[model samples]
Target: MKKRLITLCSTFIFCVGVQAQEFTPKQLEQVKQVRENALNSDLSWQLLESITTEVGPRLPGTENDKKAVAWAVEQFEALGFDKVWTEPATFPHWRRYHESARIITPSEQPIHLTALGNSVSTPEQGITGEVVLFETLDELIAAPQDSLKNKIAFINYRMNRHVDGNGYGPAVRARNNGAVEAAKKGAIAYMMRSVSTTEHRFAHTGGSHYQPGVNKVPATAISNPDADQLERLISSGHSVSVNINVQSEDLGEGTSYNVIGEVTGSEFPNQYVLIGGHLDSWDLGTGALDDGAGVALTMAAAKHIKAVAQPKRSIRVVLFAAEELGLWGAKAYFERHAKSLGNIVAAAESDFGAGLIYGFESNVTANALPIVRAIAKQLAPLNIEYIRANAAHGGPDLIPLRERLNAPIFALHQDGTDYFDYHHTANDTLDKVDPIKLKQNTAAYAVFAMMAANSKNKITNK
Candidate 1:
């Protein structure tokens, strides 16, 4: 009798557990409805077209950047977002005045190059010296100081292409630190192979860091083809002397701002789902794939959510400033809004080029995995997978929030196979974007942001 009673209790418990696990038919229907709505939305493509065509390249502290900010404000307001505003920040002003390079010895030929952001200008007449080649930065560091004295050092670190472009971070170090490192070794000037994977005649221009106390040097990046040609000449037992001139300078600080829009929630108004892309780009291209795509996607997603009625938590869109030269915009914003960080539920950034999103990862509590998984499953129709992982670096714009605020960042991994080809190059323009892929990315963001805003689980740090 005792054994039978125990068995009956066990069966009852199992039955209750199974009942709890089943979802209500109404809830399942709601999920399907949300997915369908996102798939059908056309706002994504429209937004991309408008921004890319109207604003073009938005280099930091330039006229294009200011124009982009105004355009974004108008776009958000036109989309009927409940609130639109701008937060002020300051950014260092640097402009590319002129860039030219030529091989003076071995052969007299012009080499294509672009000045790196924040690079100093050479003398009015420019600098001419023998070329010293370093396959890597470490090699240059190991060389005798006398070897680099009165010479122009060239660092040739090539970026490897991958589906995720995971090589970009490390590969970019050459561009970021190469100039300063060479200056320390007594080089008169520095040049590097553009941080790109493909061999192209177009030079890639990006930001470089000069150590605070070190003297700044003229720096530029040569196109892959030009770098290759220069390398061949040097390797063939020819003494190569080069003339380089880059008129880049710091013009003090200037005012910039982050554009913000919000769709107020129906319930948890204070809790937030933040999504954004940097509003700044390099001057070389239209910044279409670099960030115009990102801005458009975020705006479209926010507009859609607002049109459909507010979710359970507020959806905030932040178009950050000066992401190209530095993360000054993000840093300033974070400092001003530090207290509100605790209220932020989760954040996502779309800085990667306009590509179809394939997956998402988050640094959140383990208990929130089920909710995140459920959301990912909703996105499965759009071919988005979920990879639960910790967020260490969440791009430039989101880095401040991730570190200082300890905000959980969600990475919407995009197909970066072709991102490097146009990144920071003159080829990055509106024509490079595919409307179909833009739509797909918008759909992913819409579903993910909606689910995150509606969820009851708080993804707070433990």
Candidate 2:
């Protein structure tokens, strides 16, 4: 009983310490200036334009990926960051050669499609088989055993668009795990509709996984219009056969790097408030919306903070690598940094598309809520609202660290209603991102990152 009482007292004292930390009037003035400068600055747009136009697509472990690494280093050095470095990352290297799909039976027609990343190629002569269609992944899994033998399975699942981008949660299962499920039912190949909200002829490509024990199969994604036509044909009582040839080669694992830059603290230099975005992208486009914007946003934000005033804790900006190929860089970073998580006051990511930041969410302890709330009040000029909930995972790349330490990660939730339309498609070019929105995102990040890094509060409850 005595021990329990002592433990509770210690917990109370710890929480009190965190709760007592707050920004002074002078610090609040500094944060406001930082936010205002970010709003007027064109740094984010300029960086994004330069990256998308100069470096192009940064496919993992490819020559383009290497160039991107060099470009990041050069940019960071030019920006006068306190320190810049790269962490090693190893991931599977896959290349796309050719991808085509055609309906050979019932009627001759072409289906626009792109090969899923790391998907196995069809035979040299290609495979001609009846196309089996499913409305959902669940339907395909419920089909009889061996029903898809020597056949191509197509899952025509529709993805709904949302402001929060929550719709991607259910619809992406078709691409993430569809191949394995189809192989379980003896499918020769698997295909699906693009996980998009817009009905464009361009097919979106993403990574798909094949279970180790399951049979290998080529997988592809067709455009929404082609999927609609195929569904209509299926409902017309006419059997359809498709000849699909998706050529992709896996050249084994290759090394990449997680590029990092920092704004060193004036006082507690060892502690951090980290911000990041993935450096790699799909091969289809310049990755402007998916992550070029993120890269530019974080970098520009840290630069703005450095221009304003030196904070108490470091603001480290990381460009995670090979995120589209299954978080190779994120996992590597966690393995190297997990033990030092206590020093991280907060972590945030800007991977979502460039859009107006509408809401703010975080995973910090209750003791830090007031500090966050105060920051949110400052963010009001940007039209950001604070969500009371503490359930935040930071970003996809931050998953390992957040789960390991149960530490704080924050999100500046964007208006992602139209984000999926160009996601992973050939249309994900520079035009997809709005310049003002990118600046707004940068502004929001700069304020929050500066405030968190300068604060005396700890992110943990006790």
Judging by lDDT against the true structure, name the best candidate.
2
Query: What residue runs in model 1 are displaced by over 4 Å at the alpha carbon?
Result: 1-31, 390-393
Model number with the top TM-score: 2
Q: What would the per-residue lDDT of candidate 1 be over residues 152-222, giving only the tens digit for each residue?
A: 99988878899898889877888889988888888899999988888879999998989988768898899
**Candidate 2 accuracy as lDDT:** 0.88
**Model 2 per-residue lDDT tens digits across residues 20-81:** 34777788788889898998999999999998999999999789999999999999999999
Root-mean-square deviation of candidate 2 = 4.8
